[model samples]
Target: MYRFSYSEILEDAPQLARERERMAFDRALHLLRTVEARGERGAERTAAIAFVQDLWNVLLSDLLDPENALPEALRSDLVSIGAWTMGEVGEALRAPERSLAALIEVNTSIRDGLQ
Candidate 1:
């Protein structure tokens, strides 16, 4: 078995955290775009709704978990994004064309805020 150095882990932590956040954001954006393209009036739309809901649930849980190792500010930001994403997802489920723009706007706003 290979031994991992403490210094290596510490050095990689920020990059790892950034990558995880990027992956989550990308996944959410992909799901949103898929739903938008499919329209919001059938089984596909419902599935997309479920997908976004599930993703946000996982993000929120991670942020709120006591054992989560993220900094407090980062955790708070994740929780905020999860809440905003859930709202956008709900709007998209209700009205795809109208809500898609709003969802995209919210996503962009959140990304800007993160930066």
Candidate 2:
């Protein structure tokens, strides 16, 4: 087995960040779709929303941090999007039948922006 060092991974921060964002969105999309299809409304749905919320929290934290390297305008845009996402998640949970198109579109837009 080949092991990658933590430092080595951090060396490619841009690529890693993009990949992570894409993966997070994909996971969120899968979870949302599953819940929408089966109406399970169980642990999986909770976990899915949690995952998305967690992603936004990280983005918000980075945007708020003064030490972060991202430009002010870009950070502001991300924060706005993150806030909107949280609101959408709340609405989705309340009405499981409501379409997830908004959330999906937002995730796709963000993922594409990261590319």
By TM-score, who's the top model here?
A: 2
lDDT of 1: 0.66
TM-score computed on alpha carbons, candidate 2 = 0.76
lDDT tens digits by residue: candidate 1, 3-97? 64433443568667556555666666676677677665677666756766886686687578776677899889778877887887777667645
Where in model 2 is the C-alpha error above 4 Å? 1-12
TM-score of every candidate relative to the true structure: 0.60, 0.76
Q: For every model in order, what is the number of clashing pairs?
A: 0, 0
Candidate 1, residue 13: how far the Cα is off, in Å = 10
Error of 2 at 95 (Å): 2.7
Candidate 1 collision pairs: none
- Regions of candidate 1 where Cα sits further than 4 Å from its true position: 1-27, 104-115
Q: How many backbone clashes does candidate 1 have?
A: 0
Worst 10 residues of 1 by lDDT: 3-12
Q: lDDT for every model?
A: 0.66, 0.75
